[model samples]
Target: MKTKSLLLAALFAALTAIGGFIKIPIPYVPFTLQIAAVYLAGCLLGPKLGMLSQLVYVLVGLAGAPVFAEGGGPSYVLQPTFGYLIGFAAGAYVNGWLMQIFQFRKAATVFLANLSALFAVYLFGCSWLYIAMKWIVEKPLTIGQTLWFGFLLPVPGDLLLCAVCSILVARMLPRIHSVIRKQEVVS
Candidate 1:
């Protein structure tokens, strides 16, 4: 990878970690700006690097950096919310992949890509929450309860953030690409 790409990936990883600390505390899952950061990473960095950034964030948290929402360590994997951390990588990849397919020039396309990526995040997170609650944590929540806590509760805030991110990305992409092009030429 180019030096710029690596730096940007690292920057995003740091942003994600920072985002974990900025959250509105709630019962099961606190709302965080992490999703917004994830969306921006994918929209700006493209699929592979975006995914790499999120992966680095997760790995760093797992290595006990205290970078996660509720602290960090290998033991965090046992936490019900850890699945959302995993989803960050997957969602970034999916977001960038879709943007590549539909092109990121239009607001609608960017919004659509982000919304789809949101689904991926929720799918992984909700599924993991259900599994962790039922078995690992031995909480044994019903499906309805799991869905309510894991999906329904947090989604409205996420959706609003997604809309804002999509607009930001759409507006910024052209300038970002031009800069990248200039950098490549300079190299």
Candidate 2:
């Protein structure tokens, strides 16, 4: 891997970890700016690197970095919200892939890409929440309650963050790509 790419991935992972600190605690899942950071990673780094960045974040947290909204460590995987953490990586990958297909220049395309990524996160999160809550946590919840508690409650804020991230991605992509191209030529 190029040094610059690796550095960018590390920087994004760090940003995500930092973002976890800015949290709004709720019942099942806490709202956090980490999703915005995840979006930024995808929009800035592309799919492969973006996913790598999220993986780095997860590994660091698993190593007891205390980088999650709550605490960290392998035990975190048991948490109902852990699915969201896993979703972050998938969401970033989907965001980057959609950006490649749709192109980020158009505002509508950027918005759609971000929205799609958000849905990917929700899908993984809600599914994991349902399974974990029912089997592991032994707190069985109906589908409606699961959707309400796990997904709907925080969606509005996520949508707002998506808008903000889409705008930022649209604005920054050209410059970021230009830099990468220049680096490639130099190399």
Candidate 3:
């Protein structure tokens, strides 16, 4: 189980990194493929495994891998964007948790799950940004500004990714479950 978990985590991290390459830059930040990856990771992997996948991505990037947005290093991980990276873990974890706990196989259920995950991501990312700005930049940001830059700007793209990924994952669940089951059998 540990080996399989690690392997899947590595795979998701790699996928997240690759997805990060597809960027749509906004004023405050860029929209990336990570949302889709996060949604898919969570819906398919379940809460624990999905969160593990995101954690792996973060650890890999922090370890000096150039897999982060706009290239990566230790410095980038400390930047404001790092908050969003961390949020991805929350997004995936909550997304998977919702999917498993609720019947999210249908369209409406998927929508809510994705929305919940997005909300989780936004809350975490914005909170971290607010504190980081206060600590590092020495400028306190307003709720409006944070919402504009951190939450509002990213929502459209993230939602689009969520919709697409949710639909796709709904279909792919059987195959994913099969693989996980087979792994359990083999192990």
Candidate 4:
């Protein structure tokens, strides 16, 4: 069970890194479908294991794996994008927790929760970016600028990706999980 779960975590992390690699940098933040991966990890793996997946991602990157945006290692962690990286972890956990609270993994609930979790990602990323840009860059980043650069433009792209991920997961989760459960019972 543990091994299977760990394997899942690593697989998801690698997928996320792949998603991160394909991006177009906007003014406030880069646009990537990584958040879709984050949300999918949580919904599929649940909260505790979802977080472990992200931890594994961070550890892999710290170990000099190019599994993060702008590459990995201690330097990348210190980079401005680092906060957004952390936000990915937080967003995964938040998505799972919120789903558990709502107890609504139905199509409708899952859709809304996925959307909500997407916000959680951007919220953490933008807030962290604001602080980092101000302190690290020594400049005032206005709220208007932040919203425009961070939120408005990327919402559509993120929305589409999240929708695709959520729908795919929603369709596959039941069958896949059931197969695993059946194997466990047989064993």
Best by TM-score: 1
Clashing pairs in 1: none
**lDDT for each candidate structure:** 0.90, 0.88, 0.82, 0.77
Q: Write candidate 1's Cα lDDT for 58-161 as tens digits.
A: 99999999999999999999999998998999999999998887786777789888887789889899899999998999987788998899889889999999
What total of clashing residue pairs does each candidate reach?
0, 0, 0, 0
Tell me the spans in candidate 2 whose CA falls farther than 4 Å from its real position.
181-187
What lDDT does candidate 1 reach at residue 60?
A: 92
Backbone clash pairs for candidate 4 read none
Write the residue-wise lDDT of candidate 4 on 54-94 in tens digits: 87887888889988867777666555556667777887887
TM-scores of the candidates in the order shown: 0.96, 0.94, 0.88, 0.89
Displacement of residue 37 (Cα, Å) in model 4 is 1.2
Question: Which of 1 and 2 is ahead in lDDT?
Answer: 1
Per-residue lDDT for 57-173 in model 2, tens only?
999999998999989999999888898888889999998898877677765678887887789889999999999999999998889989999999999889999999888877887
In model 1, the Cα lDDT at residue 107 comes to: 79
Judge candidate 2 against the unseen true structure and give its global Cα lDDT, from 0 to 1: 0.88
As a TM-score, model 2 comes out at 0.94
